[model samples]
Target: METKSIVLLFIMTAFLTACAGNSKKTVQMAAKPIMKKHHSVVSQYPMSLPPPVVESRMRTVEDVVNNFGPYATGQLKPYFRKAGVAYPPREVTFIALKQEKKLEVWARDGGEFRFIRDYDVKAASGVTGPKLWQGDKQVPEGVYRIVGLNPNSNYHLSMKLNYPNEFDWFHAQREGRFDPGSDIFIHGNSVSAGCLAMGDEAIEELFVLTAQVGEENVKVIIAPRDPRLLPLDPEGYGLPSWTPELYRMIAAEMEGFSDAVKVSNNRPFYPASSPLR
Candidate 1:
């Protein structure tokens, strides 16, 4: 009886030991895939780092402009003083009106922007509408920003706009549109297919100003017309259903800079000697 009891106890202890070992193995096996998945995810999308500072040795758009004709920094000094802003403004906003053919430049002063100057758009294709497709010959009417600075451009010095932004992409995706087209620029030359042609002289100043202020700090607002002065009437024209809503969205953004225009009345603030021709 004693031998049988000891044998039963021994069997129970062996069984419990086996069960514990199996449990540990199972846990390790389960954790292997989880650890692998974590590693895979980390490898797939590594953390993004901030952009590196511009190297002094690398030739910049500002350096190129300085070597050209008039120095943009020198030309912008008087205008900056009149607007009560620092030289080579920290932030710059460009309001491009399609119908009016005007490009208003505003510089940041303290918390608000100060009206700088207006440049005439030498030429722009399409009448008055947002660009929807390739070869549409339409100048897009939306909020944009300077994304690229092309010193070696066919149309002289040019600054590229990030067209088809997140909003544009969303609309295109919703409509199942594939080719929205791209390469929109505020370039030089009087001839343009679907770009804002500000002429050679105008682009030089703009290009330099953009480079100096940093492209990330520049904002470009393209509108069908000056929404502040003229009301947008999509009903008046045969247009897409989304046109009116788009106009209202643009008007809302324009409202933020309304005070800048009011203070300067959309007139060139530079002195007579330093006129924006």
Candidate 2:
């Protein structure tokens, strides 16, 4: 029994538990089918694109924008106003802390980034670490860009990410994992295979905001946890050996947002009396 237990423990530790590879294919999110089922919400937050899957047959970016643009834009006005920025800032940054299950939205117009709002991740798969291959179910942890937008997504609307970026490819090539999965996204809905599910309300705001600001100007930085608040201890998790280097890169970019809510929203990410600082 003792020996069996030890073997099982080793297997668990060796298992690469994470899922960043969505779409299950050769890159484009379009290649994946739009999920038939929906998990629309009703509360202070409602669904972005409601079901019967009204937009199921609907295609084209313009069609999506026309359908949901006004609603999304209207809803976002107050947030941008509260953040003291224009309707569409010059740029935006999305920071995801996987362990915290939180996503922070920051905006700027030729100045420092100011917190706009934060959202619950709703659903994401896998453990902490960079997405090494397809179906690992791990969320990729690194600096990335909004490569494209998917108006018709399996999990409602979604914004595509450049997961296998230069860093991802370089590492994969070295490691010799040729098919390092693709079609990663931050989409709506409450189910995730290897994508960040931001739910309906959040995705509408994000999707609309991304379109308004233009995809090129949007940057995404995903990390395991907020290093500023509490650094990650590699010893505690079943992660790869190269994780430290990847974390350092994430930390450097995150430095600008350490005082996250201060510049605009005034919602401090950390409590004033907290000892973690």
Candidate 3:
């Protein structure tokens, strides 16, 4: 009976030992997954540098060019060829004329810029004037720059605009208007609330061109009207009090491009010629 009891006691101790070993092993197993996840995964909000610069992008700039470059180049190369300018000139300027709903492309050729081509704005939002506050639905007017290029845009692809720029912020701050809206872009698709919609084909061309020219090499100007034609008379326009000064600045800047020989809306647009484009 004593021998039988010893054997039973040994079995109980062995069973306890096995349970303890399993508990430790289960903890190790649970911890292993957490360690692997921490080391090998991206966070919910990825803080890494954007891809092509990094290895994170499932799609890269090369993919965009390959997918859309052929068609864009097909349409764009001719314009450059006709201008006697090399494709992807040194720099490019885009002028957005709100009243006429036209976006003109200009390229730097020897020392001055020349008119390359123009694209019809697919859609526009708001009336004439500058965007002031959030939800104002007014297209911003001023010299702007491309802030970024988005490939996964809901509207195909989009070029981000630096709206609420220093000029915008200065006015908004003076008027006590915080939240002077943002996320403005020149994107594809014929829809806009306060952005420039440049359709699929046009945006694709722009996207490819911008990627080639380098965002820093691109400039943008949004104007209320063709200041080169009709005088920018800010009188009685009932905008901001300082708007006349603004109109003068816009008109003066436009005079630089007054010489570009072009046809707008199938109508001849011949402004007084300037040495500049």
The most accurate candidate by lDDT is: 3
Q: How close is every model to the real structure, measured as TM-score?
A: 0.71, 0.72, 0.74
Span of 10 residues, lowest total lDDT, candidate 1 = 268-277
Show model 1 residue runs off by greater than 4 Å.
1-62, 259-277
Cα lDDT, all candidates? 0.81, 0.80, 0.82
- What is the lDDT, from 0 to 100, of the residue 260 in candidate 2? 39
Pairs in steric clash, model 3: none
RMSD per candidate (Å) reads 15.0, 25.0, 7.6
Best candidate (score: TM-score): 3
For candidate 2, lDDT tens digit of each residue in 93-178? 99987876789888888778877778988887877678988888778889999989888788889999998999899989888999
TM-score for model 1?
A: 0.71
User: Which pairs clash inside model 2?
Assistant: 18-126, 18-136, 18-137, 18-138, 19-137, 19-138, 19-194, 20-138, 35-154
**lDDT of model 1 at position 154:** 87
Candidate that beats the other on lDDT, 1 or 2, i.e. the better one: 1
